[model samples]
Structure formats: structure tokens, C-alpha cells
Target: MTTETVAQALLDAQVAWAINRLTGDELPELAAKAVDDVLAIAESTTMSSLADPELIKSIARTIAATVPPSTAASTLVEHSAEVVLSNPAGTYTLREVVDRDHVERITDEALGLTPLVEKVLDDLTHSPMTAAIASRFVGRIVNDVVAGNRAMAEKIPGVGSLVSFGTKAAGKAIGKTGEQFEAFFGDTAAKGAEFAMGRLNKIIIATLKDPATRDAVLEVFDLYADKPIGRLDKVLSLDDAKRIGGLGQDVVITAAASEPVLKLVDALIDGFFTVYGESPAAELLDELDITRDILVEYAVAGAPRVFAAAQESGELDRVVREQLSPFFSSSEVAAILEGR
Candidate 1:
């Protein structure tokens, strides 16, 4: 027959075979047999395979070495760097990435805008470490106050003015100007200051011992909790962003390229190859239950979907055309067609 006639005859036979066999009752039985054969072969192979410990160990070692932690970390870093370089948004400033409102809220929460501060203070003061530190501080302050009172009692009229002047000068030198000290002592410094110091010392001791003092301290902290010290908007500029981004890139690149890191990479590569090369891969595969079962199950479950997709897209026709088109002109295929 001519080439065109042969092609036409093959096409006619294909259509007939598809209609007869594909639509027949034998299809389900064929499918069932295929599944059973696959399962049986898998069970026999897998059971024999996993019985070898060395194979299991070797495969485990190979897999472990193939994806060493250092290598994985380096790969991740490289990928991250590449992504950052490619994306315009990656060049965002610290200010852009940082939510000032969220930060302010966090600051407020941490500083105890509400009862949070009191709870934190209560926890800290109640803890042995904080209590011990506070106790030591209180003891030192009490000692100094007591000593000062005694000194004042001995030389109340004489050196009081000198002490006051010297104290004010020291405070001024430190840029404090004694405002806080003045506020604490008030006019009491002029009116029986020694009596005031003794009472203040007693008050300090009482405050340390009192539970209400924790709440009082927290309440005081809350006053400054959400108060903006400076403009958050002007915190980071474009120049600052560029500088920071460049510096970060330099740090990451430098760390990755360091001699220690290179040595680590070499060591990891060498160790992995050595371990994997000497491993019992097949025996390891035997012990592990990673069989064709999962694939088979997926195939069985997804058969209807596969069929629907193939029917919808004519994928089966395309595949058959692609694979069997050349074979149609072959003598063996011609003989097979004649027999059919």
C-alpha cells in the first residue's frame, strides 16, 4: 500500500482498538491486575531490602551528608542575597520596615501604660535577684543618709552652707543643677533639714518594704510610657538606609567568604562524599518503608482526575501521536497492523 494509505489504515485500526478495548469490561480487570502486580512486587522487594542494616545506615549517612547544615545555611544565604539584589523593595530602610506605631505600642506596653508595668515591677521586686540588689542599694543609701545626718547634727551651724554650696556646684557641673534634689527636699532644706533627712530615710525604708510602692513605681513609669521622646518619622533617612544595606551586604558576604567558613565548607563537602561513598544505600532502602505504595495509592486515587483531564485536554491523543507516529511506518508495526 502507499504511505498515505498505510497511515489511514493505522489510524482506522487505532480508532477501532480504542473503541473496542477501552470501552470493554476487561478494562477494570486489567486495572485491578496492574495494581495487584505492582503491590506484590513492591512488598517482596521492600521486605527483602529493609532487612539489611548497613544499607539503611549508608543511605541515611548519604542523605545527611548531601544536605549538611553548613552547606544548607550557605545556600540559604546565597539565595537570600540574590533575592535581595533582585527585588527593589529589598532596599527598604530600617524606618520603612519598622512600624513606629507598633513599636510605640510595644514600648507603652513594656513600660506599663496600664497594669502591665505594675505586674512587671511586682515580679522584679518579688524576685530574689532584684530584691537582693534593691536591698543592697537601700542599705548603702541608708548608711550615707545616717552618716550625713550625724555630720549635720555635729556641725549644723558651721559646715552646712559649705556642704550645700559644694553639692550645688557638683550638681551644676554634671548639668543637673540640683533641680531634682531641690524638688525632693523642697523648702525642708532650710527648715530643720536634719529632721527632714531622718524622716526621708525612714520613708525610703518604708517604701522599699511596702507592696503599694510597686504599684506607685509602675504608675510613675506609666506617666512616661507612651510619651514620644523624639520624632520617630525622622529616625532613618535614605542615606542611612543605603549605608545600612551596604554594610549588611558586606557583613554577610565577608562572613560567608571568610577563611573559617571556606574551611568549613570544604570539610563538610569532603566528609559528606566520604561517608556517602562508603554507605550501604540499597540495604538502607530495604529497611525504610519508602516504597511505591504511596505513588500507587496516588495514581489509583487520582485515576478519575487523570482521565477527566486527559479527556478535557486531549492529552492522550497528543501523547499517542507523539510516541507512536514514527513507529507506524516501520515493518514490525505494519506486520502487527496486518495481524490485527
Candidate 2:
């Protein structure tokens, strides 16, 4: 045969061999060997060398920019809601989803953020608006009490006139005193409000730190765990779901494009790299609980379906031939064939 004919024959034979190996009982062995080879390569390669930070950031930006249609978002939300509503609440109980130890750990971690909480409370309590609100709240309570007293006094026999006159005098005096106090000692009143707020903060912090707080959380979880999940569509109409989905998508798009969020994404990537950059890819996979056996198992399980689909679409032979033809048709191969 001519050199080209021999090359074609060799390519055909190789493709046939590959297809047989991939589709036959030897598939599992082939998959295992492939995984082993990959693992061997991964054992020497660092994660940092494989991942390009700029490329990842570019991909994120591209995804953020490509906003799906509102209808698509709505459909996604509808499907997700349907899936969620189909399952009973008992399908995922607190114990099944997370252990008590995890809950305790999370609670402890939250408690460790007391300084951030304190700063937020300090800002809220010390605001001028807070003092004004406190003053209004106190005034409302006083008015309510006075109104109650007046109503009780009116219900009594022959004491209504006397009590009404006394109450009016007391109310006028109280109002005048309040006005005078506000006019002269506004700063002192604000300080008092701030002091009350500080006390309130202490109470809140103490409540959060209490062991009962954890118990209360657990109790709430216990109460919810057994309850059946309600049909979300009953409460949230399709229109509402669509609107919320659109709004959420818009928010995500905006946030993803924002400088702060982009910086945060970069920071997270950098943090991951800082921790795992020098680690071998195989070690990283091991750390992630993905063993070689797991990889091989998944590959063997998934490859058949994928290969079947490709074969059905008539792409398998084309792809195989495309890959093997290059080697078979190379100058060195042709020269060797000519010599033969």
C-alpha cells in the first residue's frame, strides 16, 4: 500500500481500538489508569501554577455582565420553588443538616464578633435620631397613661368632675414641664436617652451571651424541624416571584460589578491562593475529600453515558479520527511508512 493508505489504515485501527476500549468492559480499567496518570501529574503540580487569578476574575466579570432574561430568572425561581415546595420540612431536620457541635461552634463564632456588634450599637444609640425617638416614645407612654386614668375616672360615680379637673391641671403642668425641660435641658435629656440606650445594649449583649440564648435557638430549630414546608406559591404569586427574581438579579449584577465587591472577590481569591498556592493539586484534592478511587468511580460511571450520547450524535468517530489523524498523517509517520 502507499504511504497515505498505510497511514489511514493505522489511524483507523487506532481509532477502532480506542472506541472498543472506551465502550467495552475494559472501560473501568482504562478510567482507573487515566485517573492514576492524572493523579501522578497532579502530585507534582502546584495549584497556583494551574489557576490564573486574572483569568478567574475575567470569567467572574463576564458572568456578572451576562444577565439572563427576566423570563429565564422567573422560570428558574418557579422551578426552584416547585422543587422546594415538593419536599416536606421533615426531609431536612436540624440534626440531619447540622450537628449540635456545629451549631455551638457557629454560635461561639458569632459571639466572638461582639466588638463589631458593640460598635454598631454605639452608633445607633448615640445618633440624634435615636434620642428624638426615645423622647417621643416616652411622651406617647405618658399620654396613654393619662388617657387611661381619665377613662377610669369617668367610669366612677360623682368623682368624674373632680378627677377630670385634677387630671387637666396635672396634664397641663406635665406638658409645660416637659416643654421647659426640653427647652432648657435638651442636652441632659439626650444624655439620659443615651444612658438608657447604653443600658439596653448591655441587656442585649448579656442576652446574646447567655447559654439560654443557644437553647432558645435550638428550641426554635426543634419547633421548625418537624413542621412541613408550606407551599411557597400559595404565599408568593408568580408575578411576585418574577418581580423579586428580577430585582435580585439586578442587585447581583450591580453588586458583582461594583468596585468593593470585585475587590472582595479578588481578596478571597488571594486568600485561597495564600493558603493553598504551594500545595500540590493532588494534595488539594485530598484535602477536599476527593480520593483517586472516587475520581475513577465517577469517571467510570459518567463516561458511558457521555460516550453513548456522542456516538449517537455521530461525533464520537469524527472526534476520535480528528485526534488520531494528526499523528498518523505527520511527516515522521509518513516518512516511516515510505521507508516500510
Instruction: State every prediction's TM-score relative to the real structure.
Output: 0.30, 0.73
Task: Give the Cα lDDT of each candidate.
Answer: 0.54, 0.79
User: Which predicted model would earn the best lDDT?
Assistant: 2
What TM-score quantifies how close candidate 2 is to the native fold? 0.73
lDDT of 2: 0.79
Summed over model 1, clashes come to 8
Cα shift from native, residue 24, model 2 (Å) = 2.7
**Residues 1-340 of candidate 2: C-alpha lDDT, one tens digit per residue:** 8999999999999999988887778887888888999999899999889888778877766665564434566577667655554554533444666676777688778877877897888788869788567546666877799889889988999988998899889879989998999899988888877876776677778887787887887677677765554566668776676667668767876787778977788788788888998989899898899998899999989888888788889899899999989999999998898887
What's the true lDDT of residue 159 in model 1? 68
